[model samples]
Target: MSRRLVILRHARAEHGFAGPDHDRSLTESGRAQALEAGRRLALAGLVPDHVICSTATRTRQTLDGVLAELPARPSVEFEESAYAADLDTAFALINAADPDVGTLLLVGHNPTMADLASAFIDDPGLVSFPPASLAVVDLEVEWLYAAPGTGDGRILDGEGQVGKGEG
Candidate 1:
């Protein structure tokens, strides 16, 4: 059976929050972007059956916004390791997903999110994941076999932004 992975970058966050980076919350526009991203995913019928999300405030908020527009209430896992995860760590998290899930959504910070999304495709240069941006990848293998270059992915919604005009 075919599987799908949706890699999402947390929405825009305030540069200057009183707390740590992990505690930073989404900006107003970021909330709008997150909502739009969810709508677009729903529109594209990319609703996930399982979600692996970062435990950070911003990522959780982004997840909340995205989940709001989706019809399915996916089983979610709040992982602290996903907060500032690397590509390997991201893969580990992904590989640990429920094998029965046909679609999986991962929400986290960038560099990792961007790198993970790009790693699934042949041409990494073609992807640019801005805040609230998402990449939908179709995989040929099970979640246990997921790895870089294992799937073909495309940027959905916008190149580096979501809900540009509406937000």
Candidate 2:
């Protein structure tokens, strides 16, 4: 069966925060961007059946915004490893997903998110995943066997518009 993977970058966050990077929260514009992303997902008919998200505060808050616009909530898992995972780690997370889930959404930080999305396409140099960007890749293989360069998948759609504010 064909599977769909949605790669989402966390929304714009406040800078100069006196906390760890993981503790940084989304800004007002970031929240609007997240909501727009959710609406876009629904409009594109790419609503996920399951989501694997980073445990970072911004990522969680981003997911919250996306979830708010979704008609139905999908199963979600918050994983700390996804915070700053490398491409391999990200792939492993995707590969470990339940085959029963046809669509999976992964929300995290970059350049891992950008790297992972680029790796799926034949030309890795052409893709860029900015803040609050969402990319939809179609994978022919099951999640268990998903790997870099093995996706045989192309980006169906991508949106990098996270509003005209600080990111």
lDDT (Cα, tens digit) per residue for candidate 2, span 1-167: 67988888998999999999999999999999889888878877778999999999999999999999888899999999999899889999999999899999999998998787777656635556667877667787899887776654444343433222112
Model 2 global lDDT (CA atoms, 0 to 1): 0.82
Candidate 1 ranges beyond 4 A from true positions: 124-127, 158-167
The lDDT leader among the candidates is 1
lDDT of 1 by residue, 57-151 (tens): 99999999999999989999999999979899999998998889999999998899888877765562554678997888888789999998788
Best by TM-score: 1
Per-residue lDDT, model 1, residue 3, is: 94
* TM-score on alpha carbons, each prediction: 0.91, 0.88
Candidate 2, residue 162: Cα displacement in angstroms equals: 17
